[model samples]
Target: MIGNGTAVEINARKGIFFEVFLVFLKLGLTSFGGPVAHLGYFRSEIVEKRKWLSESNYADIVALCQFLPGPASSQVGIAIGMSRGEWRGALAAWTAFTLPSARALYLFAQAMAAASGGSSGGWLHGLKVAAVAVVALAILGMARTLTPDRIRASVAAMAMVAAFVLPSAWGQIGGIVLGALFGMTFLKGDMPSAAAALPLAISRRVGAVLLFTFFALLLGLPLIAAMLKSRDLALFDTFYRVGALVFGGGHVVLPLLKAEVVPHFVSENDFLTGYGAAEAVPGPLFTFAAYIGSAVGGWKAAVVCTVAIFLSSFLIVLSALPFWNDLRNHPSARAALNGANAAVVGLLLAAFYDPVWSAGITNRTDFALRIAASLLLFCWKTPPWLVVMLCGVAGQVFM
Candidate 1:
């Protein structure tokens, strides 16, 4: 409510809601870098500069969101908004965080229809590369904070490997489940840090009922649609399954999407092109469902698909986030989280190899370009958006 010099005062009830909507609107518009970069922006703007939450508290919220199933950065934004304002704030946060990228993606999908594959491919490649680096940096940065000791480090390492070797979702689920179990069964009653522990306002019973109701609706909505044999079922099914199943983040859903959409009617080449285009646009990867729906099912399908996917994503995020909060606060849960974190690393590594590295880094020039781009991102600190732009030009000229 209070900022330096300019004091914009409103009733606390309305003020928080407006602030959430406005802040998220700005974030949605300007938030350019992938998830990690988005995190950086949030930390700098909201945490450090705005003093909305302490760095530790902000990070705790982020950790909780990361372990959830939807877009991590967006969820973090929502959590911040909610923490500051309440459910209305949470609504504002999600809308602001998601709307910009979603709109941009809609434009990108339209552009792809007119442009040739060769012309737009490079920038898309660059964006993917940049995305990969951003995710890696995020994992590393998060690890530095989350894993301070050998035990935690070991947990992270194990999680990473498990992600690579088994399914990626395994690591994510493992982290949350293990973190919770460890906390409940083993970790003793150690209070959460002051910033991280807001006093529980809702009754425990009420909270449990609400959480259960939210998830029940989440699971039931799509099933209900399916039973009715809705025309939008495929789109809903795909989006719901993607929302329900995939772990790590939006990028990880590419493979699953490929498996489902490609064989049905969407061309492999077209799918990849759309995917690359999706990477270039802003918002959650799940929004790609919009493009897919538009292509296969028309505008109505696109609408249905977008709603289904977003709802599925929103529900999963809601269901999983509180549990993640509990895990981080509890000691024993922290132990299992250690392993799960490592598994996330491993899964990311695998993603780098399969889709990002293997698929993108094909030729010698492509390989060389990747190295140069990585250097630019990691060393010289060129902006990722610029890197993506340059890479696109490079892709047009060369690849």
Candidate 2:
């Protein structure tokens, strides 16, 4: 009851739409520290400052988007826009939210590659450490919040173990299957209250489909061509695949990405470094692909890679909403979501071992640092932006 059709408190001023655009654009420009920061920023600006959505509505939307794939903040931004104006407002919301950060990443990738003198070293190391720490914290926070019931927690525990032990693709697929089975078998419950309450219109479903199809073409055609000839698979393949497979949230994308891109070229060091830089930026962490792309190719590669990742992520986010909405609508599917949510813990656990813990936790001193870092994020509530910057500088200076 605050802005547009049926919703009633404010007038739909042209000025307000422009203001919304500028506001999120600024957030996109200044927002760094990954999804947690993005959500925090959204709460501070939209809910607290702008008073766009009531706190209950905001929490409901956040929970809904978390269950859906792609970027939760991005979806929340689109939903906020729709609540205010309409379809064009949604478009404007995504554009302003995404473009500035995408541009920043492209340029940043170019700069990093140039600064590193061809190989990614220097700041990249610190960035990787920061990324691993941040993601680990995220998985922990999400698990605590999402999985409450005993049956759901058990499912999540299994998912976490499977994600940790199974090969990345196999483990993720296995987790999803396990979640579905758990939902179908046990964990009976009512549908989440928020699922049936969404305000989207039927017409906008077409927009979602179009966006989904665009990325499908971008991803599917390349693989098909790879069969005919040695089609050059670049950043597109990894990011596109990462976008498609990642079901839970931004943190879920990390391990899948680690598997996809790390094996192709460079070392784990370079991979994590890019991830850190992505964390330090705004929008979505998937834009980490730009750094990888640029490192692999050049500015052209960075541009293409940035577009590919963004489009891939955008489409997946759009396509999954309906299914997610439907899934949350049922007791059985809701149970499954709960189970799947738990598995995220296992996935993070696995990631900690192989990539984060394995790489960063070398000696007792390093292990202590990591623990300190986690506490800084979780207990001290240190902002990730400041943490990442300090870490990058520290890695440059000492580690």
Candidate 3:
């Protein structure tokens, strides 16, 4: 027979899990705007209504997620869930938030597979053009917010040059590291007091284990796959590393994913097509992994790649959450994050020029279409999916 305390704990855990699932599932289905907007929705629901965390605490978590790699909004959501119910709550939040978008993209991939030849139509081209516009707008928006100061602006410029020159996973990682170092040396300013640190839900020991596991996978996965000589394992390793290392928002993953997938697992056209389709869907852009995986192999690959990408993100968030409060309150950490954020903006700008612009903006007509799409997205403040649909129709008619 269970003791009273044990029974109460079990019941409370179940309640927390279910609450996290329901709340995020709703957001996953309904959250239409990008990461910034998703944060607004999360604040409204979780902070205002549910009262899971205080405003300052939520802001601190957002700061930590922004400073680290992977999807920021998703990480924030996972952190909130963990705050409510530890690792289980974090898993619940991620699954509920990601499932709707992942399922939609996976099913769409199946449809695209069925209509293989049909995917190269004018509408698809329009989608590609729209993607170019979307990424451009993202870069502009992020730059405005992240690199306001001249010092930060310079860091962004340097990072952009490095990424443009190298155009590899290592390039991105190096850019972030350099940004942090620069931040520590040059970007230090009025730092937040350490007294404001939020309490950790998980202990330092657990955080250490999670952080250790993250590095172990990062370093060991490729070697393990090579030893086993498994193509599937290698694919998983590639996607996992990409997911683990990407800074900025979901769009930042574009160049990284393109480098990893195109000419190897999938064609360039197919990769761009999936990216376009991702814009038309709601929820996190990371779900684009599902589409890429499905296009390359089938549902099996889809499942594997999707899990691989998101699992890395999950591990990173879990590892960081337990120690984020202390990190954020430190002056050095704040300075490093300032530089890192600006560097991320630079990385996005480079991506916009390369795979996004070069691949999508082919002719004068494509350029004109992208310009119009940009106006719609930025000037008109149109919804992305709607903009995607209009662009698709415009592509069919014009391009």
TM per candidate? 0.73, 0.80, 0.93
TM-score of the candidate numbered 2?
Answer: 0.80
Q: Which ranges in model 2 have alpha carbons more than 4 Å from their true place?
A: 1-17, 47-60, 83-87, 116-123, 147-150, 194-199, 204-219, 228-234, 316-327
Candidate 2 backbone overlaps, count: 4
> Taking the tens digit of each residue's C-alpha lDDT, what string does model 2 give over 1-399?
334653432445566678778888988887776676788998899889988777877776677677655667777787777666665666677778887766666676677666754345544556656766787778767767766667767777787788767766678768867876777677664547643454555345765776669566755856765775531354556565666556665667777777776767546776766666666666766666667767777766766666655555455544554455565666776666666666666676677667876675556545545566677898898877667776777666765
Q: Which ten residues in a row have the lowest lDDT in candidate 3?
A: 189-198
- Once fitted onto the true fold, the runs of candidate 3 whose alpha carbons sit more than 4 angstroms away are 1-9, 117-119, 193-200
Question: What is the lDDT, from 0 to 100, of the residue 133 in candidate 3?
Answer: 86
What ranking emerges by TM-score with the best candidate at the front? 3, 2, 1
Model 1 over residues 1-399: C-alpha lDDT tens digits?
Answer: 247324444366678888778877877777765677788889988978789888777877776766556667767876777677766777778777776666666556556655763224665655555455544555566557555566555555554554455544344455435434433443343445554653113345555665676577656766786788766775676666656555455665665555556657466555655565565555566667777776665567777767766665555555454455555566655444444444444445555555555556667877677777778777998766566666767776776
- lDDT: the better of candidates 2 and 3: 3
lDDT of 2: 0.67
Query: For residues 1-399, what per-residue lDDT tens digits would candidate 3 score against the true structure?
Result: 469889999999999899899999999998876899889999999989988888888888887788788888898888888888787888889999988888898888888778863367788899889999888888888888889999999999999888878877777888888888998999774466334455456677887898899999999999998899886798799889988888776888887787778788888777888888888887888989999888777888888888888777778877787676667677887888888888888888887887778888999999999989999998999998888889899999988
